[model samples]
Target: MLWFKNAIVYQLNKDNLFDTQAITNAVNACPFVPCGNTDSMRSGWVSPFGESQDNPLVLDNNGQMLLRLKKEIKILPSSVIKQALAEKVTQQEQLFNRKLKKAEKLSLKDEVYIDLLPRAFSKYQFFWLWIDTVNKRVIVDSSSFKQAEDILALLRKEMGTLALTPYASDTPLEKTLTKWVKESLSFPPIILGDEIELKDAVEDSIVVKCKNQEINSQEIFVHIDSGKQISKLKLLDERGMSFILNRDYTLKRIKFDNAILDKNEDFLPEESNAKLEADFMLMISQLTDTFKSMQKIIEEIITV
Candidate 1:
């Protein structure tokens, strides 16, 4: 319930010029409207807490700000479409005394799509954004770049002149990561994980991935010797929070050890909201503390 499956981080421009008031204005600007019968998809802003729109869309969960974008999509089963298409084709063939032409079949599919949309079930998904204005970074809790882009696009539309850019640096991160492993890089409590991803410079298409093997082992060293550079590297802290840092600054994966549950005992398990808030405070505290070191390392290694 209080978990983020994935993280996609983006560094903001020097002018981090937006706040919850701006976001709330955007949320109120285009409230969610249900998908029309002819519409296959609908997306808009919604309250992070499912209760009321009046509730602040931007939450100050301790220090980390939480914003949510909600989308609804209508589902039309293929089997239903196929069956209807077959029936229509059979009827048309009999009327024309010939097979339905390609164009006619294409038109039929379009008609079927529009007809099925009304009866389709609406599915909802949320894109949770964690805004760290102090750090000038936005973290989307999604694995999909498309979903992450959708959130940014909506914000761009609502809060015009959003000058955020991809997390950048002068030197390539892959080379830095490679050097880290090759040199047995250590940042105290933040150690390199066994897993790594690499790519060839000459042939951008060439890719390699290794997991669960000693990072400094000769087996991996062979790849480094062959000119492979690390594109993504796994990192673990002393507290057992695992991170997968990408070539960009996007944090692809993060896992908290089960030991963290010990801190939750003070909060009653039945209190969902309290539990959520408590967990949020704990999670963010740990994450930001860890990320400070991570940010320092990135700034140092990437020539920021």
Candidate 2:
């Protein structure tokens, strides 16, 4: 599976961290624990090791590390909980031979919820990340900040004392993106696409999106003059990879043009285990290059 569609890059300091083994130990401590029927949720890490490749930690010749985490969550259906509680409430009211008070009904509901929690169905998801100790960066394989935070929060709980911040430049990204569209500061080697997601920085909630329209058109300039800062932008790199650059410096809506994707088709392994091995290898290799360039350009463009 193409597990990581986007990246949440972080600037990790090169201190306190000793070796890969330390991280491997932390991961081993928190393998996926199946949620019990009554439990609401249970989340933890996992070793994505298969029958053929059964190792919790994968280290390359360069010393870069990759780790996987599995989260299992279970939640009882609201309707089912309500039905059970209603039935109990009716029996209690008949026994007492009087109407139940609001506080009493609520208490009964809380008890029924606890009783039904053990029967909740479970769901599963996995998170994988790369530890670039050489570069002092921890790249999370997630699109949204909430998902990204889940990984970061867990890492801190496991390893302790992780002070990493989201990737960004000295100047605010929204301000820099506004300059790109208003003054048309087209950075060389990266072409701007005809799509944008603008927001009113003052209000923070107001937003405007322009799609398939010329980014340099006078109509867009009008919106720019009206204080709409660029929040999401579309661009194509030299290699024809297209992606949306969010103001937060996280990429979204990424698509490596078929030309690039088709090139990897020949090397895909037939065996399931071998294919996963090859896929992750190729993904980490290609994305490392793409993101290295991406981080540099963003930093340079936004910084004074």
Candidate 3:
């Protein structure tokens, strides 16, 4: 219920200024529209609070903002187009009593695409966007980096310019994670979870994935001694958040502890808007604490 499942965080430059009122006006001017009959895809902003005209295009709770991007793509299967193109090519060959050339086949495929686009089914995707002006952070609830970038790209276009950099540490994140597994690095709030993925340094293709097993077990150490490094590690925050830390420093499969979620259960399902607001506020608070802890961890690793 408006909780972030995964976070691809970006840091906004201090020099950049984000006026929420201006953004709300600009985004509302470009509300999402479905793809036209021949259009392959379309992406635009939409009201975060469902499709109700009563809700503002951007939901600003304090300095944090919630925005939604809706993208619609026509589903024209390549196989269908190929089959139709082949049929046209064969028909043309028989009509002309000659083999159809590659250029002619290409033109026929274009015709097939135009003819099928209108009849093609449509697929829709919604991405949640969170902008924390207070912390100079922008997080997208998307597991795929490409999809996250799509949101940023649109934001940049709408805002004229957006200066953001993907969160990264000076030291390789895997080194810190590997050290944690080896017990050489321990941060009190950084609790180990049961899932880890390791990859061989010499042979990049070699990988080992373990789930529901001790991260520091003898079996895991044996693989580590043989030159495997952590590629992904699931970790728990003592403050009630759990997420997988990827080698690239992206957080995936983020889940707030039930204890944290229960804090606002008093909000009834019938009170959807109020429930969403409570959830977002709680999520933002917990996540900011988690991020600050991560900053300390990154600093510690850099020194080590």
Candidate 4:
């Protein structure tokens, strides 16, 4: 038989029952009262002298209790309560383990494949770029940087005083080019010859002067990687004139020319590429770690 020990007894009024708040206040006010072991049992009688006529206490409307004390109230050690709680916690942990093992036995193929299919892409890297020529902008696929810049210039020239911002992606160039495409053509302001001065050149990248005198010139670098489908561009601003880097630049294909027209159907190819596989795997591992953490919480709850 289980030994029931370490219990608390609460004496309450026989009439004018107290609300939960009143009982809680009474418990807090009297530190010597024997409140139950669990938080939920704020006002209950312990069967210290075995079950008798006085099983539960009654409380007044104000949660006041007037009873003659048979003995002085004291804080008893909760050794038996602690032991019972420990046993209950152990049983819960065992149950949680069994459930987790069963879940692991099920297949995860469907979940993984669903999460992989609909290309996950972010534009966090290139959301805000200040262009002197155009009022608004969108990036298109192609190798001709000069043509794209010219189009943006014309658009800026047409839309005077409005802000022209470039839209770029937030992934590594190789992965972006494999699965994304642009579909519209809006021109920008004309590039003035005086605004074309080279500020600085680093390696193969050059900082080109921007047309707006209030803003600093944009730094541009062009580099090619062997396995990359498009050239990578790095933009920089020296003074307060530059916009923050927030998007990634990607291209559908590289065309070697400066006079390509802005009217054609563009499509980004999708293939079984390995460039982004490692990064994707890392993200998946993070999600798995979160799940394990939740399982640990359940184990803790059952044990306690």
Candidate order by lDDT, highest to lowest? Answer: 3, 1, 2, 4
Following a full C-alpha superposition, what root-mean-square deviation does model 3 have from the true structure? 1.7
The lDDT values for all models are 0.77, 0.74, 0.86, 0.26
Pairs in clash, predicted candidate 3: none
| Model 2 C-alpha lDDT per residue in residues 1-304, reported as the tens digit of each score | 5436677888876465536666666666666667765667777765555313265444433657677767777767789988998999899999999999999999998899888777667777777777787777888878778887887777678777678878877788888877877877666567788899889879988988889989888988888899888899888776647788898888777776666555456544556545555566666666677777766766766664
Of 2 and 4, which scores higher on lDDT?
2
Candidate 1: regions farther than 4 A off:
51-56, 61-63, 96-99, 269-271, 302-304
Over 4 Å off in model 3, which ranges? 268-270
- Give lDDT tens digits, candidate 4, residues 1-304: 0110110111122332324443334323322233222221122222222224453221222222211111122232345444544454456558776433334322232333233333322111111111111111233222345434443333334333223233322344333221121111111111111121232223324433334332212221121121222222122211111111111332221121112111111322342122122222332233223223323432433343
Return the lDDT, model 1, position 184. Answer: 72
Q: What's the best-to-worst order under TM-score?
A: 3, 1, 2, 4
Best by lDDT: 3
> lDDT for model 3, on a 0 to 1 scale?
0.86
The number of the candidate with the highest TM-score is 3
List where candidate 4 sits over 4 angstroms from the true fold.
Answer: 1-142, 169-248, 254-304
> Residue 137's C-alpha lDDT in candidate 3?
85
